[model samples]
Target: MNALVDVSFFPRAAKPLASYRKFWAARFGTAPFLPMSREEMNQLGWDSCDVVLVTGDAYVDHPSFGMAVIGRMLEAQGFRVGIIAQPDWQSAEPFKALGKPNLFWGVTAGNMDSMINRYTADRKIRTDDAYTPGDIGGKRPDRAALVYSQRCREAFKDVPIILGGIEGSLRRIAHYDYWSDKVRRSIVVDAKCDLLLYGNAERAIVEIAHRLSRREPIEHITDVRGTAFVRRSDDDTRLGWFEIDSTDVDAPGTVESHINPYQTTSEQAAGQGTTCSKEDQTVRPEPVEGQAEASTSSARTDAGSGSKPLRFMPNPALPQRVGKQVLPPRERTVIRLPSYEQVKS
Candidate 1:
């Protein structure tokens, strides 16, 4: 008889690495980021054997830090992970500097385009630190794509370029929205990436890494649960539009349903007004010259302040009382994620 023993391998937990504060301070002259130092790196045992996460975001361990956890998980799976926070994604140098990654993980705070707006907007939010770059009137350069593609190409000209963050996900369809003073569609189509992973990504990312480790082709690994990017012509035609009875249709004469990620669900497709129930729609008094004003004004009035909501209303999808049969209204194919909602179901 022979005794057998099983040995299991588990990667060590990562510790803090070299302080990122010193680097950021030298570059921007202020700290809007938490410090991650070399000593911390050594304690965390981070080495060159990690994946570089190229993104358009500031690295902070906050609630919006889902991407950070994904990176850490990759490191635990025996891959090092470094973040190129909000790099000049137009250029290739920053991405090249960090070396090639096994996977390029992307994410957005809430929406990808919105994130770009917050960072690149002429009027940006002020940080507690008075001398931050935007406060000093530093805005994102016009060449955002150039920077992103350059770094991406430099690192992995042939490696898979994954576009995931908010900017990439929401723009995964032929969306009609202004960008660089023009409208655009299908971010993956524009970015020319190998794949576009959408929604909360921790689980999908790990599966991607595992599959890649086994030398599997990126295209064949679509069984993982998440949106998968494909060429425009390859999408199913049936996904374009559904001709519901006009009278029974809830949202008519609206392109809102076309771009809504949650258009198909029963609850959403049933069509409801704003999430605010009638009881929750009470108006709050606005203070004017040290006195609260009576609530007799319009229920929806914009304050004279600088902040105003930006709204877009596309033209009617179906014409009224058409005598002849026309083309069915078609929208870009999109898979509804949990975060999606139907403005008109």
Candidate 2:
């Protein structure tokens, strides 16, 4: 009679059969489709929503890896993150997967400008190129930037859009590009994102998550570290615009005004001569001392002099290019100069 009785388990008490099937797949030859279980996803502690991180580069898990670092950082901060790798930007599926992100994260290749040029040039000239597979031919001049913006606008309305990475940074100003053969201004304006965190955005991203977690209104939260935002200049209405320290240092000025030519004034810059400061998340330019200044006279000149000081711009070659620039003496003043104390502090 006891054998005739049916065994019953509560919904919450029993492990779902799906979990067992996934485990079986893991044990067998098949790669488990979902790497983590539902319980694991819940344990990751996402705030009931996800942060969609769209990247321009291929995805991998390495310490110095930009997307990996940011993704790990976001998860550590209690946000759910879904990565869309090398998105076509032309397709809607990438953005459609996660529904909508609480925050939109972007990253570009170290050679974003060159990469886009190559991608576009390839598309324009190639007739039998089977690499794109099903991709249609009409590529735009600003293909990467436009596709990112359009998808975000279509999929996630009202959510704050943040733009970073190479595609956005080098294009942050009205400058000429060799590949596209055109001049453009800040990507933020063109892409219509609420904010753009240019340069190396790791630390800045963490602070941004912290702020958002606190429920502090995004607009009132000023002086964010390690990032740049566009706003009206103090005097000029239209053309007079630049980057200001998003912290307590409330003065507004041009993009050149906020650049730290020395990069940072902290101990981090001591050995590698790299500087990053928590005081202001913005990175300063590296200091040129001794033999480093060979053939570069602009290093010693005062900003007040008629001649330009050195300024560091992006160099796709260096890992730090995204972090700092090496400017001529005249352009050096375009970004701020960091004091020795600032570097140490």
Candidate 2 lDDT over residue span 1-345, tens digit each? 000000111122422222221211122222212112234334543332445666544456555546667776565555566665556566666666555565554444322542444455544543221222244322322446556666767776667666677676666554565555555445555676656666766656666665665566555434454344444333232232222222313333235444457654564355455546565456667766864675365555543376775886654553332333433333111232232233334
Candidate 1 lDDT by residue in tens digits, 1-345: 111110011122322333112211122222222223334444544433234565444555554555566665555555556666565445556555545555553433222343344443554543322212343322233333324644576657777766676665566654545435444545555566666667665656666666666678775554455545553333342344233332333334435544468564444534664433444466766568434344423322445344668797544674454454453433322222221122112
Taking all chains together, the TM-score of candidate 2 against the true structure is 0.48
Model 2, global lDDT: 0.48
C-alpha RMSD of each candidate structure in angstroms: 20.0, 22.2
Q: Name the runs in model 1 displaced over 4 angstroms.
A: 1-47, 103-150, 179-182, 232-345
Q: lDDT of each model, Cα atoms only?
A: 0.47, 0.48
